[model samples]
Target: MMKRYTLMVAGPLVLLGCAGPLTPRDTQQAIRQEVAQAAQPQPAPHAMTDAQAQAALLPPLKLELPKGAAEPAEPRFDLAVNGAPAQDVFMAIVSGTRYSMLVHPEVAGTISANLRNVTVPEAMSAIRELYGYDYTMDGKRIVVRPLTPQTRIFKVNYLAGARVGSSDTRVISGSVSASGTGGASGTTGSGSSQTSLETSKINTTLNSDFWGELKVALETIVGESGKVILSPQSGVVVVRTTPRTMRDVEHFLKATASAVERQVMLEAKILEVQLNDGYQTGINWSVLHNGQHKYSSGANTGNFDLLTGAVSGSLADALGSGLPAAAGTTSGIFGLAFQTKSFAALINFLETQGSVHVLSSPRIAALNNQQAVLKVGTDDFFVTNVSTTSNTGGAGTTTTPSVTLQPFFSGIALDITPQIDEKGRITLHIRPSVSVVTEKIKNIDAGQAGKLTLPLASSAVSETDSVVQVEDGRIVAIGGMMKQSFDDSANRVPGLGRVPLLGYFFGNTSQSSKKSELVILIKPTVIDSQADWQADAEATQARLDKLERQPQTP
Candidate 1:
């Protein structure tokens, strides 16, 4: 009986422990206690005194302030005065020191200020801000002047010139032609015309009158009492205005200088991708994403647009995730950008899809609002126009033919202009062109002389002009510039190939079509400091060292 009672009691105790310490009634009691405690009144903390707050905000005794050349070189001191003459106060501050104080005849006022452990200039500045006193500092001297106009000269670094840009677009839908008939003895002519549609648009931008615009802006800021004299040739501006207006001018000039002086270093790569048979539609950028490389469009890290790639095709579905599609088309000619540090890695990844060819690698630096161009190739001249002149001579009629040749540029050219803002975003106007030129012979007949031969140029060209905005250090890619070519070839036994009937049986002729895509990648890095230029130089040196290590075949 005893053992049964003990076991029964132990089982109930174990069950209670498993249920936890806080039951429903206990939880409710705890909540009630918390509510009661929160409802009770609480004591407020002590409020700070005026002097305590002042002490908290004041700088320490050894405050290392930037001392201008005009600042007085004397030990700091405390000053407490109540309604004292301004001239006396100034004199008292410089007493026993090498500095001198001069009060203008019109200057008359009473000063009341309390400052501690501050330099003479700091004390004067503090009093000026608190009151409406005007002062100027010379080496070891102070001049108190009445509120009046002041003359200040500002220096601006810019070339003395004007800039102009214009764009024009025109469309004509109809042709203009005239027809005439002539008889042996007399001439008669009849003309007819048809309705034509013509459209014209023109846009012009002028940046030539910078000084004029600046003068107008300054005049508006200073109103009637101010005068602005701009000498663009010398890069100087003289402004006579009130002290308050001068401060505003200083601020405006600072901002303008920073904006105009900014520069960017641009690196570009033009590549040709010959697609493999399986990837004819386009380059499968998903291949890079599925590989060991981590390329994501929506990643929260640095801008990766320099390595423009988008996820597509059935492979992306299998991976369960993909980078967002880039701007422009998904096939042939598309646009992609990436922001990656490794160029070699990107090139290695590209080899999986097709044969890669680097057409051009150009690097240049341009200032804000400046244009840079890079051209690589040759210029060939071909006959474009021909004219014949005849003169009557005693013996016979002499004829002379003149040929006009025009230069055809065959190669790659890139033109780019960059506009950078305070936020480090770059807006670019880019134009890229690629062309291939070949020579063909043209036969022309001269009346008495034999046939005249001239060379004509045959060309295939691809070009695009566009404007885009991107962050600093991001790569911009223009792709899908594709070209198709047909090539013919034959193979046969040397002797059998010449036999007319049997040649067809022995020789094998084949024609193949090739498709290739041109991709241009551009990366612009903002050159904010000397360190950036140093880094670029280091990278160039490293590349040179790497090339020197490679074996050369003589």
Candidate 2:
């Protein structure tokens, strides 16, 4: 007998060897057997539909591990599926693992998955993450369902100052008419009299959009049962819709209100300088040709007259003493009459010192208190290079690039609109556009307006927009322009003043310098109707009268 050797170790041992290659037919049979074996991996206790999964649930698997023995981890899956229902993908992922997955009927969608050696738990987590599905684990079973859509309520305001009732609702008023024929008792001429009362009822609501315009645009998305509530008196618009639809409604409201609202007041301070401490400012200004021509007009105040520091009047009327109004120019704010005439007064004051210029006048396009449009005209110009390619002679043939001048006119136009809320806060939308007028090379036969102009221009627009929220009655100041003035003069004895180099000693030199800042202050308020402006005027007059009646203290 040959000598036998025994080997002892902490574990068992086995012999390893490489297997010989099999024929194509044999390989096919082998693959089929492997797939058949895998088909029953992690077989469920019983087959169940999504609806029945909850009722015929998988019983908890009670497992016990020996002391000092390692617990088996979740099985990994190498699954790949193409254009399969989500349920099938989940089934593939859960096969061969300790986990069982149940997909609710609401989770209806197709899935294409490529998983590489991923654990069952990891694969389940990824499936939920990618699809935004919600899942919960019960023992070794996982339940999944699609998230339901959420609902939200949004609030906005329009037509502020109207008296909306406690319920924030309004009723429409209709007219009632009464017509009767006269009955003759004796020798009475037939006659008819009609009486009408201006009071009736209807169902209607108004907003900056006027008659709930956004409602129609959102109906398709919000569905037939969605609700839009309008409170005219409180200026509040309440929208109750799904989260996705609410977003669309919000976008619609911003656009619709921006197009038609206007009513904004700009309080501007225009000042000039005389000396570092002593200043002379009595000026009124105007602009022509879209802010190109700017000039000032005022009265003469000799010797830099001293002024009383006590300023109690409006900024417009502070310097009204020596300046005369320009012809065709009105004295009130934006051509509107209020009790206080301080705006013109301020213009009068600015003209006395130096040349005053109005770079831009506030332009109002729409005046809806709930929404408004404020604009300032700005213009710019530039040139751009053009390049073109063509197949002229033959296949790869090309011509030399030609050179030409192209004139382009670009201007800045700011369109600002605000969405007012119930608390008087505003979500301001500012659209700043660069309007381009491309100069088109035209024939001489074009009209005079086009002929005299080089490269006739066609209008186009490019815009950038943003939103900023601010409270009502707040002042926003825009400032950039600064001016510096230097005044130097000398009074000399008549004959000695002409002496060139030696005249320095005969004359006195006086020099003074002054600087000023240009500022524009914008204040927005909600006015449902013109009556609000009238109320403002009456209130101003009352205050002024009250001041005048009070005795002054020396």
Top-lDDT candidate index: 1
Supply the TM-score for candidate 1.
0.65
Candidate 1: list runs displaced more than 4 Å. Answer: 1-103, 106-142, 163-216, 219-225, 286-329, 387-403, 441-455
lDDT of 1 by residue, 102-149 (tens): 988776688888899988898888987776567889897899875578
Clashes of 1: 15
lDDT of each: 0.72, 0.47
lDDT (Cα, tens digit) per residue for candidate 2, span 181-294: 332332222233334332322221223445455456656556776776666565566766644456567787777665445354323332222222323231123322123332
TM-score of each: 0.65, 0.26
lDDT of 1: 0.72
